[model samples]
Target: MITFSKDFLWGAAASAPQTEGAALVDGKSPTVWDKWFELEPELFYEGVGPEQTSNTYYQYKEDVALMKKMALNSYRTSISWARILPDGRAVNVKAVQFYRDYFQEMKSNGIEPIINLFHFDMPWWLMEKGGWETRESIEAFAFYAQVVFEQFGDIIKKWTTFNEPLVHVECGYLGEAHYPKVVDFTRAIQVGYHTLLAHAMAVNRYKNSKYNDGEIGIILNLSPVYPKSTHVEDKKAAHITDLIYIRSFLDTVVHGYFPEELIQLFKTHQLLPKVEEEDKEIFQRNIVDFLGVNYYQPLRVQRPKKEQFPAQFPSAFASHYDWPNKKINPYRGWEIYPEGIYDLGMRLKNEYKNISWYVSENGMGVSEEERFLDESGVVQDSYRIDFLKEHLIMLQKAISEGSNCFGYHMWTFVDCWSWLNAYKNRYGFYRIDLENQFKRSEKASSLWLKQVIVENGFPMTDERKG
Candidate 1:
């Protein structure tokens, strides 16, 4: 019997390049995703690239119709930096018109758009100039942010400065998942710092814009860390990992400063990113209006006997392990921990000032979801429906205790291209039928969610069968 606020946002999210696949059409240039698939075709799942996607670029009208059918009141989508500025500085007039029309269409359908400025699809041209790691790129992003505010600030009431900046730094600099695959955490630190500075600048710009009442914030993937065991060593490991992974971004965005211990750890390794004195004050001045939290899985860490790689990344002092005998999502290979959602809510209530927040991206990604399709054109994705129910119940509990959350947007509106896994795991309320002209079909979860929105809660347990 979980209920939500009356104004709770019921919707889904998708990014520009992932869904809108007009790769190089009508003055649109390639993004890093396009160039990556070009350089490393084998890296993508089934050799699929960014160019072949859900074709929302042309099919936006039809898609908005589907959103209305699902009774969605909100939809989050990113404006493709590449589409907006093919060459990264000059605005493309045609793309501008396209977005204006698309957004207006959604509004006409009674769907409010939660627009994000950047969503990992960095313009390939921008990446060439040292993307986010250089001060020049930071300034470039701030300028682009200003342009977005000036152009769409009136039509779009809700805006996100950047979506998951940490993922960009981790994948691009520390991990090998993204383009320009490198493993230098020193460089990762620099990218992370510059991104925060960029976000602060954007927040400041938004406050000063003509549409000052419009909401602008940044989205973060805040997966909490847990100790593998009660041992002191394991607890220490979890704390260190939390400081690096979660607090490094959260503290700065909320409190306007990095975790002091994290900075000291970096200093011990002589790996701190170059910081300017004025930049510190900038963050202190412009904290976010709201927080967009994307939680998928929590990390469990165990203390290592010694430094695993002192010569490698700056914070490689701990080891991460899986929760013992944890229930797992067989499709995406992530642990199923619904309680983590509740824990996150309580953390915000107790510690993070209970600032307004939303479950911006929390959905299961499954493989070969089309197998469950019936003759009537519905994919019987009962697994996804159950997954949402479990998480939403926790969210309901959080709300009952006052977490200041107002929305819950599933990861995507339609199945779109993932970074490295491409189309391997499908996470959409609607199915993407590749063989039948990129068709979009309804899934069981969409119908179930529609009812949840209609009721503003999961039906009582006895009525669930109804």
Candidate 2:
């Protein structure tokens, strides 16, 4: 009974640094990821670096053919900032050709290409100049965005300015999980603000450019926060967590302002990031045309049992956020909460005026997938199929209730490299055997997705039972 619109886009997402091999070829400068892998190989899971990923840079045509076979009408991929602009300021003509050709190929095949301007791949040169923390780097980012808009805007109409800006703030700036690791909350706040500024600047530039059909927006990973209990303190903690994590960026991009709680928290801690008087106008003037929500899981918050740790937690830590007691799926540590999707849809619809949105990234990551393969070489990844089905059902309900959600693009097209996890957690429909020059093997979930796309709804029991 669950049916999507006939125009609903079904596809997979990938990033250049994650799937593209030949990291150093064709005049491409080293990115922060390249420098990180070179300096700290041990930081990655099992010591597997970004040197050899899914090899999609060389095999994009082959991969695109595979996507067509999977019945995809749209595809999402990021253009490496370092690839196009070697130092983040100057354009590389040869590198420009590569992406132009890539886009042309997708268009030729009747596939709509959604291009992301930046996807956590910071140029090493920019990092040396203070990266996103410095205003200079923000200007360089805007310039780079303008270059991409001018060059590829003819073919690529849908553009995402940044991917999961919160992840970059939490993981790279605050948590020490990604490159240029710095665990200062104040710096994290500044970085988060500057990223928004960069996005807004990019939006301004894209709107003023020659492209008539182009649209610019930012992609945020919106994880809905829940209260562990109905207690007043628990509810308050959940509210704070949501403001700090989700609304911090959502409000700025959608409503053209920062969350009031975030401002107060920074003011109380005396850790407010410096902002110019003119910056507020820039943010207000450059609201997004759409939003891309990447939903993985929801968080459960409750009152903290002890004092805050010696390490400075950004905001009030009177409470803690923890996952609710539920059956955990072993593939990925995230809890399965299908209703979170519906909740997020309703929240966006009510708070943000239901701006056009799409599920950018949603999937389960498995530790070891090769063991689940059947005799015919198809991996029986029923868990992934179930995960997608449950989420899609919620999405259908939300859409039917007037959410204005456009489409759904899964986490990835194939098993690609995750930042610190590297290849440890595989999250792809097409399994890539890294041992054999990255051989591609379609999993059972791929077949399931193909039928879902073709039928525009959940497949019958007989279709999925076999």
- Which regions of candidate 2 are displaced past 4 Å? 307-311, 318-324, 459-466
Taking all chains together, the TM-score of candidate 2 against the true structure is: 0.96
Clashing pairs in 2: 300-322, 304-319
**How well is each residue in 56-126 modelled by candidate 1, as lDDT tens digits?**
88989999999999999999999987787777678988988999999999999999999998888878888
What is the lDDT of every predicted structure here?
0.86, 0.85
lDDT of 2: 0.85
Candidate 1 shows a clash count of 0
